[model samples]
Target: MKDIQSLPPGPKPHPFFGNLLEFQRDQLKFVERMQRTYGDMVTMHAGPRPFVLLFRPEYVRYLLTEHPRDFMATQSAGGDLMEVLGESLLTIEGEAHRQQRRLVQPAFHKKRVESYADYMVQYTQEMLDTWHEGEVVDIAQAMQQLTLRIVVRSLFALELLDQIDEMGRNFSQMIEHRRSLLARLLNIYVDLPFTLYGKRMSAKRRIDAFIYKLIRERKAEGQDHGDVLSMLLATQDEEHPLSEQQIRDHVITFMAAGHETTANALNWTFYLLAQNPEPREKLLQELQTVLAGRTPTLNDLPNLPYTEWVINESMRVYPPVWAMGRKSLVPFEMGGYHFPEGMTFLFSQWVIHHHPDLWQDPNTFRPERWNPENDEKVQPWSYFPFGGGPRICIGMPFAQLEAKLLLATIMQRYTPRLIPGFPVVPKPRVTLRLKHGLRMKVERTATVVKDSVTMI
Candidate 1:
């Protein structure tokens, strides 16, 4: 407990605002500099609140796995997120999280996810079919649309592919506008009302309404559709089934988390591949040898090692859910840090993944580093794209399979090239997407067909 006083070290903050201004401009830069100067753990003041940044993988492991109950996800300032997320598993802790996880687990089972492979392939191919050779659009936007439709089909069982562009735009505005820099910077000021945010609040309400309507109609029908909604309904405990509110919360949570994260991962995947052709060519060669231009399946994924590594490495470089915010529930001393209950602790995958000590040539886009022989060199909590411990991404397997399948299918039929000098900056909104879209040109690959011997 005595070590808590020295809990990492950092440059003293400036007067009243502390490090808040500098942290807001670029949180990643602040973190890297702290690690460079302060070593593992560093303390910084966010307004009046003191935040301890744990940079070492070992300590991050302790926070997430070894001492999970000791920490909690810090409260959001506005308090709207709780209403939006409801008592869903993502927000809950202890017994509540355990119960919700049990109810939600079966829906994303390996067999359930494997069954979804066809829908993913169909959707990816459909999008690729529409792309005209030599034409360019924001490849990131294209990936978002593709992944959104896949989520719609897999999770909602809603045939809304044609309507996606309209719905997706509105949903995007709602997410971005609500979390605007102004809102974040001004969060410390308590005078403003929730409605002051204007249209974003309205958009969020509408999204909630739309999801509730779907839940109502599904309930009225009362038949299993073999999708996530159906699975949630089918699951129940001794006293009662999930309430209407519970259903809405889970649906909205899934859409927000499931849709956005996967899209960004795909966007980064394509961007990295476009920039590095050697790996792309190698991936294509593997596809050719393994499936011979046919769509990939679960059975085929294990053999497509390079393709899998490409996606894995892309996630390493730009993890969609960049940081985990935890507040200590009880006084506990950590590696050379003091014990203080209620202190907010941040564990950033953004920092951990690129920690120079953990990764070789940390900034380079190299996929081979994840190969079997090199994976051992990686450390715990240092490279968690889908998090770790008991509360790991339930859809981890499902997400991985969907991503690899989509990549294989698209790479087989078309070679997408990044438009020269396209602004590929990451906008760390709800997920890491391009502040400006990732533009790319696609060239169709010739399909090879071989005839069986029928000579008389």
Candidate 2:
């Protein structure tokens, strides 16, 4: 392996602005072009600041796992994300991050997520019931509602469907406002009000208001509701119980990040399955054999191996959280590069997961690659859909369980066929979702019941 500084050379960036112009235009395309031009390690200057883009799995493993302390997460990029997430675990660092993680980890424990599985299946089935056979439905929006309902139910144990439309509107407006060019330009200054920055500020106020109201209601009841929200309200440290702001921040963080990523993942999985029927057939076959028309539970997860593999494969190709950025707090040495302190170092899953050198037929939609029989043949870090190391997504296990259960449940009931000539393109928004929606013609399958009767 070459030293960090001596890694593969990239495009010569213009002075002052450096590669900022190209990146601002379309980040995904810019990274793809750079990867094609400069194998794994690409050096580009973002506004006079030299940042190295590490694409190799080995390098990603080193930074995220081996030298974490040296290469901490960059607040600049994540700072924008915090417009919605607040100082949730995703943004905090060091001791504060650790403390927050400890406080929040209990809610996503295996038992807890398992308990939520029944709700996931039930909600998905309920949503599917509304889908008409010939009616063209937006699969993405449907999944969004299904997953959001599940999140709301599991998180608060409260019915939120009535308020869901409002919540979705505010959330979408906030994310868009923060993602716009004007937001980026305004972000150049640290002191600007979030309103001045973009449309997200008002959305934040609305969301926070709702969350705080919910928290206060729980507090007024002063009862342990046996839900995640109750657990959060019950959580406390020796010095202080989580402040109202803290509760609202973490709740809203999970509420938004929780459903959106899994929904997009399932949406892509369905779209991919539609485009490639063989994989879809295999997945359904596995579900039929393992589940036998019944809803999958935590116990059934181990048996539904193919379903797991398909979701993993989908994530490999289109990871919802596509990129990871770390700003060097101090100089670090890897691949022999002398990265200066405070420079942002990025490792994009889009680059590593799709690299020709790392994967066979990198661009193909092949879930079999993740099958146990073949997956062992690949390098350890060759594929990371939920990321790696200590900073890896904490909700990964929860998300996986939710996705697989939902996939199995839906496949048991309906077969969605993607409409022909409909342009299906992946857009790198907050998550990798269809720029448009996946319009699929869902055909209701014959309902299968137990007692020695089966129908397809």
Candidate 3:
């Protein structure tokens, strides 16, 4: 082991708390301040538990890809999340993670995910139908609900679509409670009314009951529903079949993972487009030309490079998964520095996305940087919005398709204009989101063809 005092330079510790209070106050701003003050790397503590912050792309790549096993994904909540989520991909590790990834990989394959294109377009349209033209809408809230419905319909089919309202309310209460002080202490084990832990368990029970009911119905029907549920249930011929608990865990995990990230991605994409007029116009032009006043489908993606660019750049600017860290299992050396074992070492997408050296004019929303002609100029791990390495998000293909189609569908008919004087800031909890919901004024346009349908 190396000397603790020899670690990289960082902001002065605040006696007992170190940087914990500052970190808990506003992590994004703290990270930016650290980056400016300490350059590429910093060593600080969260109440005496010191961690390293690697803001450079080179360091991030080594930690995530080259020597991934040297670090473990979860630092503090490994046991906690596993208790709630089971041995699902997010919780599992080593060979177990590999096997689960293999089992779930096929469902998200490009060709397989494209089959759900019609569902994406249809569900998005259903959402837009509820919005009155020129109404002030909270785009963030709207996208969350829209993506939630899409997750249900696309992954499990329409059997549960009608129950979305009740489910959403229940889920909201549960998630909000999960963030409370009492719930964090209980950590998913405790149950019963008067406490936060109890409320969370109740929420989980409601959610679990709903999930188990879906599983029972799917198994009863015994017919393929052409969704994720059907795929998971079709393991009859396999030597190793998923247990009831395993299936339930996976369904709940996907429900939590799939919709939330995509919702934020869509939310930030619209926010970026609204703030930057030139790219917004460019995206609109590309949509009009390629889509020809029709809703977009997965097949039409290649022709809409600018649309893809916009989403990519938007994620680069405001990544949904803003930061992630791993606990160092063993000591390591790189760039003439030591990473002590048993300490948490973390990196932020926000830090890398805006790194001065890695990105030119990193603050600007320049979709053109993603153009093929300039592709080689970017280094790996510099713009990882959905994570990287073996544990990269399994739903990447599905999410990209969903975002593009949703963008084309909505932009084809209306442009969501941000309401003036509404302060926009990110609340980077679990996922990066608007501090106050994104308020937008929806203005309908004649760009869409009323009879148009997405071409298969």
Candidate 4:
């Protein structure tokens, strides 16, 4: 094994805090500066733990695909994810992760996912119905609420409907609590009402109570509701039936993963489109010609290539999951440096997607870069907004479908223009969010309106 001196170059760290303060100060900018100064692989530290930040596409491919078993996914927000997510697919590794993935796989099958399109379109229309011309709205929050409703109805098949808003509030509060740097660093667990950790725990309790109640009801009914919860309740290994907690874990995982990332993606997409009128017009023209002011269906997705490209480009610019961490399972050497077991490695979608080596003008919002003609030239892992390899997000298909349908539905009805001089900043939390939220004024579109559009 190479000596410690063989480690890649990076910014000097503090004796005790290491690079934790620098990293927490501004994670995106810190990484970008490191990449620009230190090159592809840079050794850094977070507290006493050493970390190597990787910026190359090949390194990403190697870690995620070539040597996946040598590393495992890391827990985010200081291991508190386990307390909230339980042993669901997001938190586990190795055989347990595989088994849980197997049990949950059928729920995301193309056919099964496509069956939810009716709900996606219906929910988008319901949200749009609330919009009025010349009124400013926080599009970010709107997307979150819209996706929350869609995910609840489509995945849990919950009919209470009214409780969805409460559920969404709790989930949002839990995420906000986790976003607290002090809370994460301290790993706080004080159960007082005023504390962030306490608030987080309270949110978890409410979410758990709701999910367990649903699981118990589903078990008692023993009938297919044609939803993910129903499917999980029905499927069982010969030797091992899924426990009530297991079911709750899967439901919560889907509830959090299903809606939050998609909402951020849609938020970024609208923000990008507002800033780039040329591409926005191109996307609008595609919606006019293909969708023709009618609601979009699953079949029309293939016809809307530009719409897909716009979403792809937006994700490249502001990936919802901006970075992911994986801890080494055993000693391994990568990029000419030896890494000891338990070393944490981070790869940023923001860095690689904006790297000059990958694209002609990486920072420029250019949708045409994703055209079919350039597909062959695009490198593997170069634009992994949803990550890569076996653990690549299972909700990718669901998120893509939701984004396109929502974009089409919203754009066809109203044009969201960003309020001038309103600051829109990307805040990297569990997902990349707008620090101040996206404020925009909605203006009515001139597309021919059908008397009524029916869901398929």
Candidate 5:
């Protein structure tokens, strides 16, 4: 074991700014380089704050599962997230987090999440209807719009359907602002309309107002709509029911997280399939045999194994929530090294997913890697697209179901081909997004088997 006081190896930091400039220039490359040069445990700094980047799968399992109490989820951009997400489950910790998670858990229960499948297919089909065979479309924007609609419908019922476009715009602005380097470095709080911080604040207020209005309307109706919002409003602890603010916090958290990650996941999936024709063909074959051009239901998921693998592989290559961070609540030792209190640990799914030690051809798009017959058994914490352990994404079931249904529904009608020479770059943001958006030409599938195939 290494000395408890010894710090991990990493690139030397520039005084004052530390490694902030290097990190800001390109976070993905920086993290990958650190792991390659310094091995599993790498230390760096963001301004004055020192952080340790853990690269091994065992390290991931330890922080997230084995000794979860030693750390807490670090706030985004230093409390900028809390300003937007409020005291929602994403930001809180300890018993309060447990209680809130308990109250909100039922909304994401397997049965409840499965109930949204029809809506998922319907919205996707509706989006597909707008595409013409020869038209060029931004697939990233399209996925974002479709998921925003599905999440709103599932969360608030159809009440927010009409406001989807406006809500989407505001949400987009909020995300851009949150991820903006200028916003993070400057910590500008000027409330003027011209400032970046001001504009994001405005967007937050608009969203808050819209949600508050809906909450009031729902409370007045006093009827369960069988949507997540209704479920949350009714759930309570022994002391009292969830207040409107608390419910709004959860709503905003769900709205932002619920759609953003899934949208990017689909964007990357389509891009991967377009690039790798064999997997694409296999996926199409699976859809053709299993779905047979029919809308996929939750029950159909069992038969669509290749579809799941494609998504799994895509996430492994380009995880939506690419990185996660945690702050030490107390001094701890791991990987034979010790950390001080308030130390931050950053781990990247992108790096781990692409780690040479963990995966073969780590950068290649290979859905077959997930096949049980492949002979390479994936260890625990080896692939966590939706995260892991107790605080794993509550919406994992919902996001998976939505992605599968949407992919099946769209592939049955249209095959999106990436435009030739179109540059697709991954932007490390609140999620892994295409920096320039995914521009693709829509081509109608010629051989979509219409006759339903019997499930074997």
Candidate 6:
């Protein structure tokens, strides 16, 4: 506790508020400034709490793995997520987390998750089918609606294709309110009228009622459908099965993470592809040669190396789950400094992914850098799109396969181009979303259609 001066250097704190004000203005820019001015590990304060920002991959490896037990996931950072998601694997710890993870792990296994590829491509095709040539569309919104429907269908075996518009309308309203400042700062779940929290809970209940109704239907069916809900229903032992509330938590967790995170990845990938025609062209070529105008499958995944690289590079630029905050559960020691318990530790995917030292041309969207022929090996703990270690995202394979299938399926049918003269920027909320969403014009591909009619 007495070694405070040995901590990493940072901007001088305000006498009262510390560096909280500066941080709130623009978190990404402020962290970038801190890394440049004070090196990789910068110490800043949120109010009176000390937070050390760790940027290096070695430091990331150390914190998430080597000294993993010394720190704990902070509720302050994911508290808002908890209220909306309840106590599924994301917010729990210890034996409960392990147990829940074991229950859910089977759903994301390679064989099982891969079997859903047809559903992935089918849903993607359904969405693309609605998009006529020469039509203008918000690709980001399109992706959100698409992924939400995909997750709902693939996870629950329920078709929301026709109901997507209504479901998405309510879900988006809920998500917006859930991620609002009042919802985050206040951390109150009560439904108060004319307030964001109130609206969020209302929206949540709409989704919840739907989910619980489905759960009841599935329960009454008394047969396994091989969907996630069935697995939850099947789980029980000498002890006890999960309560309805717990199952709802897991369902909501999957709904938010499965749809939201993957949609952001797809949205940003197309955003980059719209600008970088070379990579996009190469991607189309791969789909033409390998897939030959057909949709991509898990079997084709390994063969489409360039397609994977494009998404990798996109994530490197804009990781969906950026920045993780944790609290020291014990007196923590790392980077040659000592910290007492309860100190905050901050890690930024944006900072680490863009660190000039780790990535050459860190700001450049060059997927070729990741090509196997280039012999480019990502340093351990450096490129964590879905995080790392034992607690690394369970849905990683699900997301990767889903994104690839969607990209390949859509790219086979249309060439997406960003609308001219629209400023696209990152809106870093719980997940990094596009500010105005990716507004783009879609042109039918010659492979899928002969006409050059535009979709905008």
lDDT of each: 0.76, 0.78, 0.79, 0.85, 0.85, 0.81
Per-model root-mean-square deviation over C-alphas: 4.0, 3.4, 3.8, 3.1, 3.2, 2.8
Backbone N/Cα/C clashes per model:
2, 7, 0, 0, 0, 8
TM-score of each: 0.91, 0.91, 0.91, 0.95, 0.95, 0.93
- Error (Å) of candidate 4 at residue 104 is 1.0
Model 3 poorest 10 in a row by lDDT: 75-84
lDDT digits (tens) for residues 36-105 of candidate 6: 9999889997656577888899888877888767767754433366767789877877677778888778
For candidate 5, the 10 contiguous residues with the lowest summed lDDT are 447-456
Residue 295 lDDT, candidate 2, scale 0-100: 74
Candidate 4: give its CA RMSD in angstroms. 3.1
Ranking 2 against 4 by lDDT, winner: 4
In model 2, what is the error at residue 132, expressed in angstroms? Answer: 1.5
Q: Write the per-residue lDDT of candidate 2 for residues 209-318, one digit (tens) a residue.
A: 87888899999999987788999888898775688888887888888878888988999888888888888878887888887777777789899888888898898888
lDDT of 5 by residue, 1-456 (tens): 234237888777787778988887888998889988889999887766678998889998988998888789985323368878898988889888888999999999988898899889888888888899879999998998899999988898874556777888899778776535545666656777877777888999999998999999999999999899999888977685798989999999999999999999999998998889899989888887887668888899999999999999989999999888888898877888878888888888989998887788888998899999889888778788877777889889989998888888888888889899999999887788888999999888655335643321
Clashing pairs in 5: none
The alpha-carbon lDDT assigned to residue 179 of candidate 5 equals: 38
Error of 2 at 184 (Å): 2.5
Scored against the true structure, residue 405 in model 5 reaches a CA lDDT of: 89
> Which pairs of residues collide in model 6?
133-454, 133-455, 134-454, 134-455, 134-456, 135-455, 135-456, 136-456
For model 5, the superposed segments whose C-alpha errors exceed 4 Å read 1-5, 76-79, 159-161, 179-188, 448-456
**Measured by TM-score, how close is model 6 to the native structure?**
0.93
Choose 3 or 4, whichever is better by lDDT.
Answer: 4
Query: Candidate 3, 56: how far from true, in Å?
Result: 1.5
